[model samples]
Target chain A: MTVTATAGQPAWTHSLFRSGWLDGSALNFFLEELNPAWSLVRPAVRIRQIIEETHDTRSFVFKPAWGFGRAIAGQHVGIGVDINGRRHERRYSISSAPARGLVTITVKREPNGKVSNHLHDRIKVGDRVFVSPPQGDFVLPSPAPQKLLLIAAGSGITPLMAQLRSLLSGRYSGSIVLLNYVRSQQDRIFGAALDELAERHPQLSVHWCLEKENAERFSASQLQQRVPDYAERFALLCGPAGFMQVVRQHWHEQTLDERLRFEYFGTPQPFKPDDKPAGVAAHIALARSGRSIVAEANQSALAALEAAGETPSYGCRMGICQSCRCRKVSGPVRNLLTGAVSHEPNEEIQLCISAAEDDLVLDY
Target chain B: MKKPHPSRALSPQEQDALAAELDALRDSVVADLGERDARYIRRIVRISRYSAVFGRIALMFGFVPLLWPLAVLALGVSKILENMEIGHNVMHGQYDWMNDPRLNSQTYEWDNVGTSDNWRKTHNFKHHTYTNILGLDDDLGYDITRITGAQRWNPGYLLQPAYNVVFALLFQWGVALQDMKLGRYVLGRRPLTEMFAKLRPIVRKSGFQLFKDYLFFPLLAGPNLLAVPIGNLIANGMRNVWTYSIIHCGHFPAGVRIYTRAECKNESRGHWYARQMNGSANIEGSRLLYILSGHLSHQIEHHLFPDIPAHRYPEMAPKVREICERYGQHYATGPFIRQFGSVIGKFFLYAVPNLQRRPRTA
Candidate 1:
């Protein structure tokens, strides 16, 4: 049931992708400790049983031969798997609790996910994987036993289950109001385990619902009415981008709720849009001798001013990223990032990103 | 089978082309900074250190009754330039081993020299990150600049080159202003450190003294001190172009080009090596070149290994060049005259200050 639910990757992951993360700056720090590229750390876990959660989601259970360290419910670790010729890595949260060492990873296959699909079809028990230490700030707040809420639409329940298992094991005895919804009752993952947990803990309650369930099962409306205690609990919602949007719109009346926590799947949101401007166009040239390409534009006076020829030295094309920066040879440039303007602007403008509105020349 | 966005977005052919160009350029930049240029920088660090000592002695004797009082003043100018560069290099952690706390503050102490803001920003951030990002780069053309460089002669210059002489001869008028202007740039661009924070109060006072002495002293030079004024005029013109030509020579090579964000993404670190090599050319390592290049003649080495002491760079540069060649990269370098010519080409054809770039053909 949770198979299809867990397969969906949130859109926020795109934000976390950065170039310097693989940089040599860390080279100095880690060079003596490990090889420049790969490091062998202590083993994280030993694969045990694989559980099929839903149509698209499957949980690979692993027993920690070495001790599995504690991790925050929403935290993640970068897992690198050797596939074909490349070592592919991605971050994932452990679904099981620390005490069990039975690490359960609920994976949902995407259209062309490299590592995800590989894990789905090829991975099995006894396979050793390289993983980084636990990394992330998302977790349940301490000083527990307070009224808490856990909201998940699909596979977002992986981390929430960790929290629940933690509570069940007495690491944290917080009162949780776990509200998980799926397409149908049969699609609901951990249905048997959730019912058992509810039976064991007096304070732990589960409000499971299905948007489209069997005729005999309660629907979304009935489930909404069933969870009458939501108004009082802290909301930690995790799901797909579109799911969150719908959930947010559904509770627009309470949009200003202060106790809201969310974990999106992809990159962290930047303060501003990555594609804010139409972007400066310039006709930047490259020297005939070198391979450096220039940025050139026609409409922007600044870009036009830089567009002297067809060639210039450029490494990266995404402007505002700093690969195509060049000096002001003759005219003025209004820096797009910081609004200041100046000349004798030795390296005032990044040509690849900035466009020229005037006739310009570059040494390339 | 579906592929990730990366494999599909940049076609295999395009990636190959980008990769090839990147390797070629990186090789050029590394070789540009090689093993044979040790003596040139030795002179600058030595001259700066010795001149500073000379300036201190002259300051002590400036009260002499008949000892040609101008001797102290003359030595001071030589002291400031050499001292500033020495201060510049040391802030990069050059003198840490000397063990003089004043010479090597626990916190890399260039700020106390009243020159660099924080060595990190200028040396580490701007020089290293973008090395020379055209827009965001603070290395070559920050809104703020030392009063004595070509950007001074280039577009939107606030001062003229003749001020270096005026700064030397009629220095009472020009020196303070120069110091003040240079200070602002450092303050704005410097990577603030503990030493900088500690010396902030004094730096603020020296900054104030700039105006009081330069602007107010003219009324006191008593009108007939025209020799100082004539000297000031010569210095101004000489300083601007001299500094301009020198600084521009560091990164403004005919082969050197800037990369955009998109361009950088396609590039791996190996590719960045290409950018630095083709992006900057090393001029001949000569006494004159040393004075002008600030030992930056080893452009590729400096870019590749920023933390190694600049003095050591001349010795270690060849190893770096070899690395580039082994990697199938370019190490762009040449004689001083060739470098100077490249600067001229860059200034006219490219430095329009406009960032409009042409479509990059892989």
Candidate 2:
């Protein structure tokens, strides 16, 4: 299903121009001006179609630019969109089967989400969006497991849908039990598609859990009763934090954690200093200015710096603009958005969304 | 060079009022930044790049009478726009909201001999934070000439008039070397090994620049080797002298105030804004000159809002001037000739030693 498309460039010319005197900038400029889908470096894609998946969610089908590569099913890619002249990048899980020519990403509108709202309302077919190569290890493994269980809630159904379609389309011949929870049928993404898929596929079973109806809430005992062989199935979980927390606890209690894989979206809850023992505070060093300030475990590096009366240049206090991105010469910092703890030395970090986890030196 | 009459200093409450008003103006402009500002910068980039490419091509045929001068002019325009309107403003994080990697302050490399990394420290952080404070801001005279009486007069400065011409002609070289702290190394304060280590990046950057302008492009011209290199020299020379004049006018002009390091310690936001206003001068010019100067023509407004888009400085200037006037503050601005002439006048004035040790502040 993957296509190996390459932008034509003479190897000798590329090597010759690779000298330090020239940058890809000039070529990138002309390429972007001629057609947004053309670029020397970034993988720019054009929106081929917009699919209305639900009342609140829409799926965009993208035709990759020249030299585009294939993405694995059940993986996420960072999509860059220009809204109000400012470029904002957000990671979206691919919601389509891994195939050549086109890729689809389902976006759910969030009230305060700038990029999401633009994707939902302003963006149209044919607009170009810059995309990062598909990433994340939440995809189905090679030698697909037999008797799989996929649990998704609300918009979380996107990635699971990809995996489900990929599995049904000759990747796996095993049975898959899909558990999808939504507020109502109106909010259920891919409701009709799931129904059609279930009707055509004999080994696939789809369950719809609507919170608006008097459907019983998911429980460990209920799951055991519903599927007697649940412990034997490799399970993929995606939902709100509370739902995932409940499932995680149940799996941990049963010592079946090895069989369960989960992914959550949206702004991650910051590390709670109150939950941790004392002495979790971080010391932040401004390398160029030769100043140091202590950041409480609860505060972001930017907040701590501002509180200490240092005016580091910043814009859009959120991580969207990357204006406050600085070099972290050394330290551990937890990204407030993705909840990823970075321990890499001399890495670039956004001060607005990163909370220092230890003594940190920044090239500020 | 006669000093202008000092304006009345404001109290803390008055200063706070001025800051709040100016801050609100800045907020309004920031809120309104959108497609127009983004388009403006991109257009400038396009024009700059096109000019550079076309100029080089034209210079390949520079043996023709009309093409030589026109090619050099175009190339000069390209370099000026790249360094000033584009590179300088973008390095201030002005277009960071656009989120384009090409315009990102920390990562952007300009068509200059100076490395952008060195500039982020020497210019963006130090020069800005300590605008006109003697012994703090390296830009006070770029550690070469004494612009302010606050700096101790040394015997080396007696040849400043001659050095000023050389510095202006090779202005970019001076800026590129500013962060190297060559003086300290020469004075035995800095180690030779450390200085050489720092020189590596500068050498690499300058090497590529020299190669592109002098050797590579000219060689690529095939038969027009001599003409192309001469065109590049003219272009680079034009940019150097022009930038030198514009920058000197904005900073070292007569009537511009200078401060001491002690005077700026623990400075309040209002006082800082006040200092930036006092320490900088502006040149009245046409729209073309404004763009050519990267809107550094509105140097007072630029110093106040270093992070704001330079294109917006023109709009912000009158409002800034009004605020200064209401606060009984001096807003220095004049025609380019007058301002630049005063800057030249200071070269001679400070070349001879300040015989009497006056108060530390100027």
The candidate that achieves the highest DockQ relative to the unseen native structure = 2
For candidate 1, what is the DockQ-based docking class? incorrect
CA lDDT, candidate 1, residue B236: 35
lDDT of 2 by residue, A103-211 (tens): 8899888777777787887888878788766776787778889889998887888889999988898757898999888988698899999999999998999988887
- Please state the error at residue A261 of candidate 2 in Å: 0.4
TM-score for chain A, candidates 1 onward in order: 0.61, 0.75
| TM-score of each prediction | 0.38, 0.86
Task: List runs of model 2 lying over 4 Å from the truth.
Answer: A1-21, A40-43, A66-68, A270-364, B1-5, B355-362
lDDT tens digits, residue span A318-350, model 1: 331233434333334444422334322122345
Question: What is the C-alpha DockQ of each candidate?
Answer: 0.02, 0.34
| Fraction of true interface contacts that also occur in model 1 | 0.00
Model 2 interface RMSD, one decimal: 7.3
